[model samples]
Target: MDNKIVVITGGSSGIGRALCNCFIDAGYKVAIASRSVEILEKVKSDLRSEGHEILTVKTDVRVDNDCKNLVDKVIEKYGKIDVFINNAGITWYESNEDGINIKKHKEIMDTNHFGTVQCTKYALPHLLKSKGSLVGVCSIAGEVGLPNRSAYSASKFAMNGFLNSLRVQYLNKGLQVLITYVGYTSTNIRKIVKDDSKSSHFPPGYGDAVKEKGMMTPAEAATHIFNGVKKRKRSVRSSAVGQLTVWLNKLFPRLNDKLAAKYYS
Candidate 1:
């Protein structure tokens, strides 16, 4: 195909799904991957557009084999990948004192941090060959640790560090690795969070707080991400709140900590 191609992991819903639709609307060949074949098919059906290619892959980013398969399948369909998005991630609430679910924390890391690592590792060769743009769907939690998102924060921090190094490593090779410090957006992630034990990592009833508040829509976040990738930006703060977190943590570390404690504690 003469047109460019984009591949998005975790593309069944939320920001990933929004990116798939956005790229489809922009006339790019889009490949959407997730572990759920049913949801993936639903997304493909909903987002299908004329004269644009949309392929779905059942991929579990936590497994290296699954990640490799996703990359290989995409390469098989599209000769080259023009843009690769490592958007597969999972998160649950955790705290040192009360909601400390150690196992759940590890699970979060497996999916959020290592999942991105696995996908990126497999996709790197193809990305290098195409000199494509690569984006990590990180969170504001990556910049500063929130009270109840220790694991999630750690994963995103890892993501930023990893991609930052990758960006420099590939800069001379004409490849782009960008990070998006996304703030809470209206998505089903909160609703779908795992509770591995009776004393769940999640608070009893705090699931949709991000959505209930006037959070940014996934579409808006995806638009910001797409634009950043286009401009070859090193990072894009998906929300002013996320930007505030980064700046405040930088300039007024103590005050930022106090505020976070007050809000989340």
Candidate 2:
């Protein structure tokens, strides 16, 4: 991985942060972007001490300009981009009872769906220049609708559709596009759960403990992602459980629906 230029968004925390550490250890020059400059800076500082080239950029994926700036900065500094990972995302706890909280739903769409679109669009040219790979960390949620997370599921579903179309278009260019179906990962996203009471339409349950039981650690998830990128795989599903979820959803949609309803309840 030495001398390879890799850009990861939402790199300040969770799976993204773990990827930063792994790639750096493999001798790659890595640039991490996120809305949190403080954490990014700390990550950069820590990696630099080990003689790894690291760049941290504060970015809000909701902004097109920020995405452009991220890619531009990477190119200006490294001369070429070998891989682009669109990992920035947000998730909310909703039960579908009163319908999704309009504000939170919009926020999820803006950050997870639209934000990914913006970053992918901006990075396309740079990636094309090097015939680089593009990766999106979608979820098993993308494969099937969950009971409580209407908007979050919809956004991920949309990401899958959009990236699939993009992959076909880029295939002829000798560029690879990979999207992953990640089950659970020990990420700060669960710890930061938003209270739906503030937004009455939203569901009430917080997912902190639930996620702890179902997901792998961020480091474990990062390892799957690293191997996927290194192999230039068309798609990477993080674990057997995640892949099984997709298959079960496809074969027994109603069964899973009932099970999910009970699980959420």
Residue 129 miss distance in model 2 (angstroms): 1.7
Give the Å error, residue 184, model 1. 1.1
Q: Model 1: per-residue lDDT, tens digit, 106-224?
A: 88888888988898898888888988888899988888888777777888888889889888877799888889998778787776764333324443334563534657888999999
TM-score of each: 0.91, 0.90
Per-residue accuracy of model 2 over 1-265 as CA lDDT, tens digit each = 3488889999988999898988877778889999877888888777778777688889999999998899889889998888899999988766445565889888999999998899999888888988988989998888878767787798999999999999898778978898988877767776666533433222234356445665688888899888998898988898776676677778998887786565543
**Number of the top candidate by TM-score?**
1
Q: Give the clash count for each candidate.
A: 0, 0
